[model samples]
Target: MTSQSVTPASAPASAEPKVNWTILLLGFAGMVIGQFMAILDIQIVASSLPQIQAGVGASADEISWIQTAYLIPEVVMIPLSGYLSRLWGTQKVFLLSCSGFILMSVAVGLSGSVEQMIFFRAVQGFVGGAMIPTVFAVAFTAFPPAQRVTASVIMGLIVTLAPTIGPTLGGHLTEQMSWRWLFFINVPPGMLVLFLVSRYANFDKGDPSLSKGFDWFGLVLMATFLMSLQFVLEEGAKNDWFADDEILLLSVVTLVTGPLFIWRTLTYYNPIVELRAFANRNFFVGVVMTFTVGLALFGGTFLLPLFLGRVRGYSAAEVGTTMVVSGLAMFATGPFAGRLVRLVDPRVLMFGGFMMCAWGMWDAHAVTDQWGFWEFAGVQALRGVGVMIAMIASQQVTMSTLPPHMVKNASGLVNLFRNVGGAVGLALLNTSLTTNTALHMSELTQNIQNTNAGMQGMLAAMQERFADSVDPAGAAMKAINGMLLKQATTLAFGDAFAMLAIGCAFAAFVTLLAKPVKQQPGAPPVASDAH
Candidate 1:
């Protein structure tokens, strides 16, 4: 295999480039596994919370942290993935990451305490983070530009499957089995990915031609900033926002470290992310879209499972089953949608995607305690189609414009937005959830008459459960508390759906801002690399 070099645009008009589907599929397998492992872990855990709480005897705070710990590192590690992929070859780093992730998953399964489990989960996310951008970088590189849309489609399908399948699988494990299986299940697939990647993908000492120097300061500071920000977002809702000293500390670190990180990259010749890559108008615009996409995509994904379980009284497995069709829909649609972008302009497709997402949110907003399950399945399936259109199209557009050399850094920043959007959206939506829940509960609890049929029914049940030992006042308070919790959950889901719709609208506005694809090949790009 001779190394072919091009100046970094589309393949040179004169160069008859070859496509390698075999290598690309091999790489995709690794990525699909990694994505499935990391995200499925999240969804599975969401449904298994009740079982986990029971088995570990974990407190609510501990349970929340179990999720938060994994989430923070998941986003933070995304930016680092590019740097690490470059420092280590993309294939090398990806394989090592899968290996590390599997080990961590095993450890998480073995964890006996809440603290230990959260710690191991975070470690798992940290390793799993490398899978995406590195996978895309490799996919885009190995497969010719003609096949990029196809690769993007496959990528979207595989990535979305984790969240789509996770809930049902999680529900089954938690209900029929134990929550620990959610983490343990990754072990088999992870091993397979690790083995196949090692056998199939080859990594040359990456760009060994580069000077041994890079701006170490920028990398360290940036990681600190992103990691800090992730911590704040993940913990902020439970920590009472600005009131907690830990949040304040993390805020100060993020505020201070972020600027310093930017300055270091700008001032130094070598930076962790080639700061120049962001200089591409198309790439920068892509990153912006990713940020918003992350917010809505991950935000909605996180909120739904939680709301269904907490507010609507759906068992984890039941809720998970509703979303199972979603993965299938995405898998079915991703490649075709990617190819469709070639025929239709991306902006039109992207705008359509956002509109579809908004429509789905509107559909989702109508969820109720008594809502039928199929309605949700339809909502999720429709949402999955919309996400595919936007994601695959944007990836094609973003990759089309950058110099091949800059793809890794650009991919990293793009992945970062994907993660941060989810984390920040989680914080924002959860905040809304907490506040709205309170107000809804207050409004619903008004004018409660002790003799009212509903009240009488609840109080009577409470009285019987406690027998004559139950104080009338205590039983009434308990019933009211349960009612308030139920009402609040309903209100919170409504707020989340509304917020997602608005956010998708904003995403549509931003999509219109993307510049047309330059389609230049074999020429150095004008934008500065983000390194």
Candidate 2:
């Protein structure tokens, strides 16, 4: 059967660029699989860090660089995608990225040393990062305005649900198979997508000769800024922030280089990145919304595994199973969210999504040490609903308003904020977890004095239980302190959840600031009247 042709949204229908829907579907297949690989890889590694570290005999400090190395290049490449796409064509850049990603994945899997693993992972990140924004460009350019919502819904599911389900899937893989399988797992799908992309995708063509005028200085500044910023966030918690000379220096570098990169991008004729996408009111609001989405997504994602694995003594796979409810929720609501965008103001969807997420975070706020999988299922599911709604709405709210020519740059910007937000949010939340746990520990320890009758009774009870030990009193105190520490940490987890709830609630209010897009029945989207 011949493929159905789609007209580019930017052009008049009579003079529209003809694109085959069969080819488009094939291309989208490539995009979706690519995105899933990129997002899922992050979570999979997170779920099985201990095994991975031991497999390579990496120290705890050294193991962190595995993640950090990936993130730095990933963030740096994200903003540069627009320029690269225009310079090398989306197809070539994407194809090159996929090819590089697959090779790096293979190398990473085969790596027997920490050095090799970090090197390959960083290269993988550089290539893999470009795949994400390229998918968005294809969606906007390949589909007409009428079908953009449908495209957004699909992107929304991949964006929101992949990380949600990553731990569960990663846990299962690590428990049932080798840690190397985590990297190897991307091979089949990545290869299939690679084939589909090379065979079917042809739009967004570029001239490689344009690289001659590329802003090398701006590139240097942006890379330094992103790398330094990533180092600060990733190492900040372990290094105790400014107390570490390395982190302090990186922070200073980030502060100095960030503005210069922005200044260069804004002033240069042929910049490495385009920052003007933020000038659009709708895109600006969308960036804010995307940032919050990332913050909540990553913060909540990190918190659950910590709570389940540490506090409840659950295995990685079990934690993943517990979190799968959120994934299921996203899958269920994603179609509805896609349909809703075409019928109502997108801001409404954003509001509903943010509020739902807030509700989930608030519901899970009072988490206790004794809480089980079922206790969190409802709250996790609620988060799924929120993410689906907000993600889909924000995609429409942001992308639909921008001219088709600007979609690529806009996508790069949107994903950039999402990533940066995740990094910053996870850092802040982790810091809070450590700080609050310590503070709570201090308070709880002070109340354990034997002056109180209850404390005396507990101590006596513990002593009796350990009467056969060499130092029963010391043993009893040790056991009590361990229990207190666990309790303190659980309370700290609760505090983190509560803070996320407040953040989501604030994001919900921020939804009102978005320029709403209303599509009347059988009519195109109407421009915003909101100031």
Model 1 per-residue lDDT at 288: 75
Off by over 4 Å in 2: 1-19, 518-531
Per-residue lDDT tens digits for candidate 2, residues 144-256, read 65566777888889988888888888888999998898889888988898888888877668968868878889989999999899888878997899999999999999999
Write candidate 1's Cα lDDT for 1-531 as tens digits: 122453345757767555465765775676667766766676667777878888788998789777778766777677777777777777788888888888998898898898888899889888888786777776666666555666677676666666667777888887787788888888888888887788776633466534378656676787689889988988888889889999999999999998888888777766677778777777777777777767767776777777666766778877787667667777777766865776778877888887788888878876776665676777777778888788887787677788777788778777787778778888899888888888877777775643588777876777777666638668667866886778678867887888888888878778888887644343222221110
Clashes of each: 14, 1
Cα deviation of 6, candidate 1, in Å: 22
Q: Which stretches of candidate 1 lie over 4 Å from their true place?
A: 1-13, 208-211, 446-470, 473-481, 518-531
| Model 1 lDDT at residue 289 | 73
In candidate 1, how many clashes are counted? 14
Q: Please give the range of 10 consecutive residues that has the lowest summed lDDT in model 1.
A: 522-531
lDDT of each: 0.75, 0.85
